[model samples]
Target chain A: MTQARTLYDRLWDDHLVVERPDEPALVYIDLHLVHEVTSPQAFEGLRRRGLLVRRPNRTVATIDHAIPTHDRSLPIADRVAAGQIEQLKRNCTDFGVPLHGPGSGRQGIVHVIGPELGLTQPGMTVVCGDSHTATHGAFGALAFGIGTSEVEMVLATQCLLQRRSKNQRVEVTGRLRDGVTAKDLILALIARIGVDGGAGTVLEYTGSAVRALDMEARMTVCNMSIEAGARAGMIAPDDTTFQYLHGRPFAPSGRAWDEALERWRTLVTDDGASFDRSVEIDGDAIEPMITFGTNPAQAIAIGGRVPSPTDVPAADREALTKALAYMGIEPARPILGHPVQTVFIGSCTNGRLSDLRAAASVLRGRKVHPGVRTLVVPGSEDVGRAAEAEGLADIFRTAGAEWRAPGCSMCIAMNGDEVRPGETAVSTSNRNFEGRQGRGSRTLLASPLTAAAAAVTGAVADPRTFA
Target chain B: MTPFIAFESVYARLLRSHIDTDQIIPARFLKTTSREGLGRHAFADWRYEEGGQLRPDFPLHHPSARGATVLLAGENFGCGSSREHAPWALLEMGFRAVIAPSFGDIFRQNALKNGLLPIAVDAGVHAALADAPPDATVGVDLGVIRLPDGQRAFYPIDPFWKACLAGGIDEIEYVLRQAEAIADFEQGAR
Candidate 1:
C-alpha cells in the first residue's frame, strides 16, 4: 500500500523531473513570474549565452518593485528606474513573454497579480525571483523563491534543480478572536518560533483557524513564510480556494474548470501523514500583534510591554539590545500609546480588497491625526479600480491619507516612497528590518486595522478599541 | 562563477544575527541592471555615515577586519529578500566563505551558485570561532571547514553543487545536456 503523504509530499513528487539521491532533484516549473528588479541580470545572462526563453507562454512579467506609485502620466523621474523598466519591456517583447507593464490594467505587484489573474493554481509549481513567492502556496502550489541564476536557468529551461524540503505543520486550532487577523496570527507564530525556526522546511498551515481564513487572508499568512526562514508555506486547496479562482482571468472554463476542480479537491494531506516538525498555536489566544524591533520575530501583542534585554536569554540579549537601540524604544515601555509619525497600509502582505475594506472600516468618517502622514497604496490596478468602485478610495482620501496607484511602494524603499530618518511608521508590510523603509527609519509592523488605528490616533493603538 | 578551491584568509567578525539582504545591500543601490561594483555599497548603512564618510568603527573597516576574506557571523545570516546581490557584493568584497550557525535558505543557495561558500557550523564550533581573535584565520577545503580551535568540521553540501563550485561549471549548460529527458517529462505530464 502507498504510504500516507502530506500535501507537500504529493506536490513535490508530482513535479520531480529527475531525481538525484543525496542531491537536489530536477523539477519542472508550471509558472515563472518575473519582475524588473530581479529579471534584468537573468535576461542578460540568457542573452550572453545565446539562450531563448523555453516556454514564453508559461512565463509572466510585471513592473512593481522600482516603479513610482504617483503620477504615471509624467515620465519616470528616476533615470535608472526608467532604464530598468524600459529594459524589461524590451526583453519581454524580444523574447515573446507576456508583460503586464504600466497601463496594462493588470499591472501591479507580482504576487498580487498572479492569484488575481488566476495564474496560481493548486498542485502547480510556481516560482518567482521575489522571496514572497511563497504567497502563491496559499493555493496548494509548491511555490518558492529563486535567485537570478536560477531565474536564468528557469528561463532557458522551464525547470529548476531544487531540494525537497521537510514538512512542518503550523496548525492553529480554535477560531481567532474578534479584531484579530491573519497578520496577527502569522506575527504571533513567528514570535512563538524564532526567525529561523522553520529553516529547511515547507510549512503546511492547517486546522480550523487556517481553514476559516479567506483566500486573501491565507495569502497574507503565507506571504511572510520566508520571514520565518521556511523555503515555502502552503495551505491545502478547498472550496474557499476554488471560489477565489473561479472567475479569474486565467482560470480554466467549462469542462477544464470541472476537471481542475476534480483534481484540486484531492490536494489535501492524507490521514495518518506525519510532519517532520510540527507546532500548534491556539488561535483564540492570538491578539493583535505588532513588531517592536527589526525582525518579524521581535513581535509582541499590542498590550504587552517592550521586553527588556535582561528579560531574555543571554544568547538573545545582544540582538534585543541592538534592536531596541535601532528602534529608538526603551525596554519595559508599553507598546501601546507609542507615537508614530507615519502610517502605511499596503504591500503584498496586506494590500488586497479585503485588506482595504478592513482599513476603511476604521478610517470611514474619521480624519487621520494631523501629526501623522498616511499612505494607502493598492496591490494592483485591478485592486485600485475595485477599491475606487467600492468608495474605499474616497474614504482613504477623505480621511487625510494619500490614495496612490498600485505598486510595491515604500515596502522596499526603492520607489522614493519612504519614511524619513528617525521617524517611526506603523506599517502593514511584512519585514521590520533596520532601514527597511529608509535609512535610520524605525518600522513597527502591524495589521491594516492596527495601522489605520495608528493613523487616526497617531500612536500605536488597539484595533479592538477602535471597534 | 569562479572555481572555489581550498584556501585560508583573515576572517571578519560581524557577529550580528538575522543580517538581512537589505542590510547587506540596500534597495536603493539595486536599480542598476548589472551586478558589477556592488561591493562599494555592501553594508552601506553600517559602513558609512549620512555624509558618505566611512565609519571607522564599522566592523569591515576595523584594523583587524581589513583584507578579511571570511565572515564569522551569528545565526540566520542573509535573511529576507531573494536579491542575489547580497552574495554578489560579498564575493566582490573578497569574502570566500561565511561561517555561521545558520543561514537564510535563499541566500545560501545564491551564495553557493556564485562560488561563495556558506558553512553552517554547529553552535559549539561557531562559538569557538566567534570567540577567537578578530584577525584569526580560517580554512575551507572542499566540504570541511577548519576552525582556529583545531576543530575540522565537515559541512553539508549537495554533491552536484560541490562539483559545480569546484569546477565552476555553468548550470544552464549542464541542465541543457539533458534536454531530451526534460522533453520526455513534459510529454508525460501533458
Candidate 2:
C-alpha cells in the first residue's frame, strides 16, 4: 500500500527521468511552448552549441510578444520587433519546429493557443519561457515557466533538472457569489496571503469553489498564481477539464480518448493527502476586487477603501506609502470612482471567449464613456473568430471600444500597444507592476466585468452596479 | 558560462522587497536578441532620469556603493517575470551574487544557471548584512557567505548545480550526456 499522494506528487513521479540523492531530479517535458521574445536567445544558444532541438515534434512556436497585434497583413514597422519575429520564424523553419505564425489561424498567445489547440492536457509536464505558462496548470498538468537557460536545456535534451517543491493547498470554500469572478477571487487571495505567500511551493487550488469554476475561469485563477509567488498552481482534472479537452485538435481521439480519460481521472489527490501548507478562504464573501498598488497583493474589494500606510506594519509602511504615492490614491478613500484613461481587455489571463462574452454582456445596450479609450484585444485568433461569430466584437465596437486583433496587446506593451506615461488603465490582465502596461502607467488589475464597467463609467466602478 | 569564484567585495544594499524583473530590465529594453551590452540599461528606469542622466538618489549610484559586486536585496528579490535578462543585466553590471531573505523561484534558478549566485539568508542575518556599511567587504565562497562582521552562513544549493558552477560547465552538455536515458523515457511515455 502507498501513502496518500498529492496531484503534484503523482505528476512528479510519472515524469521522473532520473532521481538521485544530493542532486536535482531530471524530469521529462511533454510539451514545450515557445514564443518570439524568449526563444530568440534560446535558439541562439542552441546554434552556438551546435545542438539540435531534441524533440521538435513535441515543441510548438508562435509570435505574440513582439509581433504587432493590429493589421497582421502589414509589415511589422519596428525594426527590432521585426527582427525578433523573423528570427523565430527562421529558427522554427530551420529546426523543424512547428510554428503558428501570423497567417496560421492557430496563431495567438502561446498559453492561449496551447489550451485552445489542446496541446496542453492532463497528466503532462509543460514548460514555456513566459511566467504565464502556469496558466496551463488548470488542466492538472505540472506546468511551469523556465528561464532561457532552462529553455535551451529543454530544447537540447527534452528534460529539466528540477528540485521538488513543497505542496500548498489553496482551498476556497463555498460558491462565489454573482458578480464575484475568478479574477476577483485570485486577487482577494493574493491580498490575504501577500505577494510571497506561496514562495517555493506548488499550490493546489481545491475545494468546492475552485471545482465549480468553468475551464476558462479555472485558467484565470491559475494564471495569476505567479503573482502570488507560487512555483505553479494546479486544479485537479474532472469533468470540466475532460469536456474542455475532449474534441480539440491535439487531444486524444476515439479509443485513445477513453484511455486518456482513465489516466486523467486518476490525476486527483487521494483522500487524506496532506499538504505542507494550506490556506482556506470563503468564496461567498468575496467581491469584485481591484489593485490599489503596483503589486497584486495590494488589492481591495470594489467597495473597499485604500488602506492607510500607517495602519500596516512598520516594515510594510514604506512600500504602502510608495505605492499610494505612485498610484496617486488617497489613503482611506474608496477605490471606486477613480478616473481611468484606458481600459484594456486581453491577456493570457482573461483573453478567452467567455471573458469577451462577459464584457460584451455589459456593453450590449450601453455605450462606453466618451473619455475612456477601450481596447478589446482577444487572446488568440481562435478566440477572435469565435467572439466575432457570436457578435461580441460588434457589441464592443458599438460601445466605442476598439475591437483589435489577437495577441498579448497592452498586457506586455511590447508590440507598441501601450498606455502612455501618467495615464491610468483599468485592465483585466494580471500584474500591475510599475511600467507593466507602459512606462509610468498606473494599472488597476480587475476582472473582465470590472474592466468593462470602468470602460463604460470611465472610472473604477463595481461590476455588480451594472449587473 | 563563467566559473563561480570565491571573492571579497563591498556589498550594495537595496532593501526594497519584491524588486521585480521589470525593474531590473524593463520590457522596452528586451527587444534585443543578443545578451551583451545590457549592463548600460540595467535598472534603466531607476538608474536613469527623464533626460538620460543617472539619478543621484538611487542607492546603486551612491559613492560608497560604486563597483560593488554583491547586492543585498530585500525579501522576494527578483519576484516577477522569468526573464533571464534580469540575471544577465545584473551579471553585466558586475553583480556576482544577490543576498535576500527569499527569491522568486524562477529568478533564483536563472541566476544559478548563469553563474550569478542567489544566496538566501534568514531575516536576522539579512538585517545584519543590510546594516553593514556599503564599503564593508564581504566574502563569498562555495555554498557559504562571510559577512562584514566575519559571521559565516551556509546556503543550500543542489550539489550538481554547485559542481557545475565550480567547474564553469555549461549544463547543456550535462543534459546531453543523458540523451539515451531521455530517449528511453520518451519511448516508455509513448
Candidate 3:
C-alpha cells in the first residue's frame, strides 16, 4: 500500500520534470509571473545568451515596483526608475510575452494580477522573480520566489532545479475576534516564530481559522510566509478556492471546469500524512497587531508594549537597541497612540479590494487626523475599479485620503511616492525592514483596519474602538 | 575551475543576524546589470559613513581584517528579497566563502552558482568559530569545518551540491549531464 501524501507533495510530485541524481528534481512551471524590478537582469542575461523565452504564453509581465503610481499621463520623473520600467516593456515585447503596462487596465503588482486574472490556480507550479510569489500558494499552488538568475533559467527552459523543502504545518484553531484581520494573525505568527523560524521550511497553514478566511485573507497570510523565512506557504484547495476561481477570466470553463473541479477535489492532504513539524495556535488569542522595529518579526499586539531589551535574549540586545533607536521610540512603553505622520494602505500583502473595504468601513464617517497625509493605493487597476464601483474611493477621498492609481505605491517607495525622511507611517505593506519605505522613514506595519484607525486618530489606535 | 576542496583563512566576524540582501547590496546600486562594479558597494550603508568615510567600528574596516576571504555572518544572512546581487557583490568584494549558522535558500543557491561557498555550520561550531582567536585561521571543506588544532566538525550538505562545487559546473551542465535520463523519463511519461 502507498503512504498518504499532502497536497503539496501531490502537486510537487505531479510537476516533476526530471529527477537528478543528487540535486533536487527539475520541476516544470505552469505559470511564470514577471515584474519590472527583478526581471531586467534576467531578461538581459537571456539576451546575452541568445536564448528565447521557452514558454512565453505561460508567462505574464507587469509594471509595478518601478512604475509611477500617480499621473500615468506624465513621463516618469526619476530617470533610473523610468529606465527599469521601460526595460521591462522592451524585454516583454522582444520576448513575445504579454505585458500589463500602463493603461492596459491590467497593470499592477505581480502577485495581485496573477490571481485577480485567474492565472493562479490550484495544483499549478508558479514562479516569480519577486519573493512574494508565495502569495499564489493561497490557492494550493506550489509557488515560491526565485532570484533573477533562476528567472533567467525559467524563461529559457520553463523548468527549475529544485531541492524540496521540508513541509511544516501551522494550524490555527478557533475563530478570530472582531477587528483582528489576517494581517494580525500573520504578524503574531512571525513574532512567535522569530525571523528564521521557518528557514528552509515550506509552511502549510491549516485548521479552522485558515479555512474560515476568504481568498484575499488567505493571500494576506501566505504573502508573509517569506517574512518568516519560509520557502512557500499554502492551503489546500476547497470550496472557497473553487468558488473564487469559478468565474475569473483565466479559470477553466464548461466541461473543462467540471474536470478541473474534480481534480481539485482530490488535492487535499491524506488523513495519515505526516509533516516534519507542526504548530497549533489559538486564533482567538490574537489581537490587532503591529511591528515597532526594523523587522517584521519585532511585533506585538496593539495593547502590548515594546519588548524591553531585557526581555530578549543576549544576542538580541544590540539589534533591539538599534531598532528602537532607529524607530525613535522608547523601550518598555505601550505601543498604542504613537504618532504617525503618514498612513498608507497598499502592497501585494494588503492592497486587495477586501482590504480597501475594511479600511473604508472605518473611514466612512471619520476624517483623517489633521497632521497625517494618507494614501490609499490599490493593488491593481481591477481592484481600483472595484473599489470605485463600491464607493470605497469616495469614502477615502471624503475622509481626506489620497486615493491613487494601482501599483506597489509607497510600499517599497520605488516609485516617486514616498514617505519623507523622519516621517512615521502606519502602512499595510509587508516588510518593515529599516529604510524600506524611504531612507530614515519610520514604518509601523499594521492591518488596513488598524491603519485606517490610526489615520483618523493620528496614532496607533485600536480598530475595535471604531467597531 | 577546480573544486573548492579546502581553504584556510582568518574569518571576518560580522555577527549581525538577519543581514538581508538589501543591506548586502542596496537597491540604489542595482541598476547596472553587470556584476563588475558591485564590490565597492557591498555593505555600502554599513561599511561606510554617509559622507563616504569608512567606519572604523565595522569589522571589514578593522586594521587586521583586510583581505580576509571568508565571512562569518549572523544567522539568516541574505534574507528578504531574492537578489543574486547579494552574492555577486560579496564575490566581487573577494569573499570566496561565507559561514553562518543558517542562510536564506535563494542566496545559498546563488552563491553556489557563482563559485562562492555558503557553509551552514551547527550552532556549537558557529559559536566556537565566532569566538575563534581573532587572527585564527580556520579550515573549510565540503562537509567539514576544521579547527586550527586539526579537530573537525561535520555539517550536512547534498552530495550533488558538493559535486557541483567539486566539479566547477553550473546547473546547465548538471542538466546536460542527465540529458539521457531526462529523455527516458520524458518518453516514459508520454
Candidate 4:
C-alpha cells in the first residue's frame, strides 16, 4: 500500500536517521549557513572539544551584521566588532568552510547569499543561526534558525536532534490589490493569526495568490514566519521556483537538474492530506500595512486607523495602551500620511534585485524630501552589483536616496547605521520595536515601494499612487 | 558537582512577548565583552533616561513593583536574536525565574546556561498572569506555579534542563561532571 503523506511528512521522513521514543530524532541538514555574529562562540566550542568540522563542505559562512557597508576596507572602527569579524574569518579558514567576506561579491546577508548562490534548493533542510533563515523556504525547503549550541552540533554531526512539528496550511486567495506587496500580506497574516499562531507547526503557504508571487516576494512572506512562532514556512515548488534556480552558481546542471526536478515534482502535499490547523484569507482584503507598535502583529492597513485599546480584547487592552503610549501614537487615528523623518529600504526580508527594481519604479523621476534621509542598502554584494548594473542605483541616487553597499545596514543597527533617536522611519526591515533601529528610534514597517514613497513624500504615503 | 542554582526574587510583572535582546540590553551597551554589570542596564531603554536616570514610567522601576523576583511574561518570550546578554542581563537584574507560555529556542538555552529558570506555563495561565496586578506576587516553583488567589498549576519542564536549572549547572559543567558516566556508557556499549 502506498503511504499517504504531506510535504512535511515526506521531508521529515527523508531526513530522519535515528528515532528514539521520548527522545529527539536526529535529522540530517542538507545545507548550513553561518555568519559572523553567531558563529564565533560555536567555533570556539568546536576548538575546545578538539573536533574539526565534520562536513565543512556543507557549510557556508558570511560576514553581514557587524561589517560596515560604507567602508569596505580593513580596520573597522569598532574594535570589538572588528575582532568578531576577524574571528569568523580565522575560524572558517581553519575549518575549511567557505567564507564570503566583505567585498567578496558573494558576501551579503546570510539569508540573501544562500538563495542568490543557489545553495538553497527545493526539498532540502537548511539551517542557519539567524532567525530569518526561513528566507530559504521560498525554494520549498525546510529552513529554520538554530542557536549557537545547535550550530556547533550541526558542524560536528551534520545533523540535529529535533522534535517534529505539526503541519499547517495558510491559504491566501484572490489577487492582491495594487500597492499591496508580500510584506503587506505577511503583516496582515500576523495581525489575523497573532504572533504565536503557528507555534509548533510547519506552515505551508498555498493558493493562487502565493503561486502568483515571484521568488523574492515569496521569501519576504516566509522570512517572517519566526515572528509568528512557526518552526518554518514554505511554499510548494513550481515553475517559478524552478526558473529561479535554473542558472544559479551552485544549482544542479543539465541532467542533474533534470533529476532534481523529478524529485522536486514529488515534494508537494498530497490531495486530501489533512493539516492540524488551517487558515484562509482573501488577499484582496489586505491593503498596504504599517506597524504602529513594537510587535509585528501590532499592524493595520496603511490607510486604516490605529486601533483603540477598547477595540482589542480586555485581556490585551493594557498592552495596546502601553504600546500606544510608548510610541506616542493616538488610538483611532489614521496612520496614513504620518510624517516620517527617515526611510530605510533593505534587509534579508526585501533587499533582493526585484525589491530594488520595484522601489526604483516608484522613485524614478522623483526626489526625496530634503528633510528626510533615505538609505538603500542591498541585501548582498551580488544584489548590489545587479541593482547598480540595472540602473536602479542611478534612479535611487537621482531621487536623493543614498545608495549603499551590501551589509545588514540599518537593519537592527548593529553596524553603527542607526535611525536617530525619536525619528520615525518607514522601514522595509522586520521588527519595529522601540530602539530596534537605535536607542529610542521609532520604526514603521512597510514594503520597499511604500518606503520609497515615504522617502519622497516625507510621510507614510501610498505606493499605489505612484503605480 | 552539586548544582548550585541560586534563585533570586523578582518583584515586577514582565512585559509581553517578543521582549527581544535589543530591548533587554541595547546594542550600545553591548560594546563590552565582559558580561558584568549588564544587569543594571537590563531594559535600559524602558528603565532609564538618556542621562542614565531611572525612568519612573518603567514597570520595573515603579514603586509598586520593587524587589519582586518572580517575573510573569507573555507567550514566545525573548523572540529575536541570539544575544546571550538578554539572559545575562535578566540574571544580573535579579530575575531568578521567568514564567512564560513559551520562549525563543536560543534564549531558552542561554537562560539555562546562565542559571535563569525559564518556566513554560500554559498560554491561558500566562494570560491570566499578564492580567494580574503589577504588584501581585506569583510564586514560580520550577515544578509548579502558585497564583496569589490560591490557584495552583503544574508546569511541564524538560527534566534534563530542570536538573541543570535546579542545580545551577550549565551544559559545559554538566557534561564535564558526567564524563565518567559518558565514558562508562561508551565502554559498556562497546
Compare the candidates by DockQ and give the number of the best one: 2
lDDT of candidate 1 vs native? Answer: 0.93
Pairing residues by index, what is the TM-score of model 3?
0.95
TM-score of each candidate structure, all chains considered together: 0.99, 0.99, 0.95, 0.91
Residue-level lDDT tens digits of model 3 in A1-467:
29898778888888887775766888887899988877888888788778788779989999888777778898888887887777888998899999988788888899998999999999899999878899999999999999887888888777888888888899999999989999999999999998878888899999898999999999999999999999999999899999999999989999999999999898888999999988888898999999999889999999999999999999899999999998998999999989999999999999999999999999999999999999999999999999999999999999999999998878878676778878899999998877778666789999999999999999999999998
lDDT for position A162 in model 2? 90
Q: In candidate 4, what are the lDDT values of residues A1-467, reduced to their tens digit?
A: 27667788888887876566765566778899998876777788788788788678889999888878785765789888888788888999899999998767799999999998999999999999877888898888999987666777778777776778899999999978877899999999998897778778888999989999999999999999877878889998999999999989999999999999999988999888889999998998889898998788899988899999989888788888878887878999998778899999999998999889989999999999998999999999999999989899999999999998788888879888999987899999988877989887889899998999899898888888888
Could you give the candidate ranking by DockQ, starting with the highest?
2, 1, 3, 4
Error of 2 at A83 (Å): 0.2
| Candidate 2 lDDT score at position B69 | 92
- DockQ (Cα-based) per candidate? 0.83, 0.84, 0.48, 0.27
iRMSD for each candidate structure, in the order shown: 0.9, 0.8, 2.3, 4.6
Instruction: Write the number of the candidate with greater DockQ, choosing between 1 and 3.
Output: 1
lDDT of 2 by residue, A193-292 (tens): 9899988899999989999999999999999999999999999999999999989999999999999999889998999898999999998999899999
Q: How many residue pairs clash in each candidate?
A: 0, 0, 0, 9
Better of 2 and 3 by DockQ: 2
- Writing each residue's lDDT as its tens digit, candidate 3 over B1-190 gives 3667688877788998898887788766665545568899998868887788988898888755777889999989889988788888998998988989889877888888777888888788888887777887788888887875668988777787788788786666455455565555445643
- What DockQ would candidate 3 receive versus the native complex? 0.48
Model 1: per-residue Cα lDDT over B1-190, one tens digit each: 6787799887889989899999999999898899998999999999999999999889888898888889988889999999999999998888989888889999999998888899988888888887887767788887898888667889887788888988989888988987998999999996
Q: Measured with DockQ on alpha carbons, how good is candidate 4?
A: 0.27
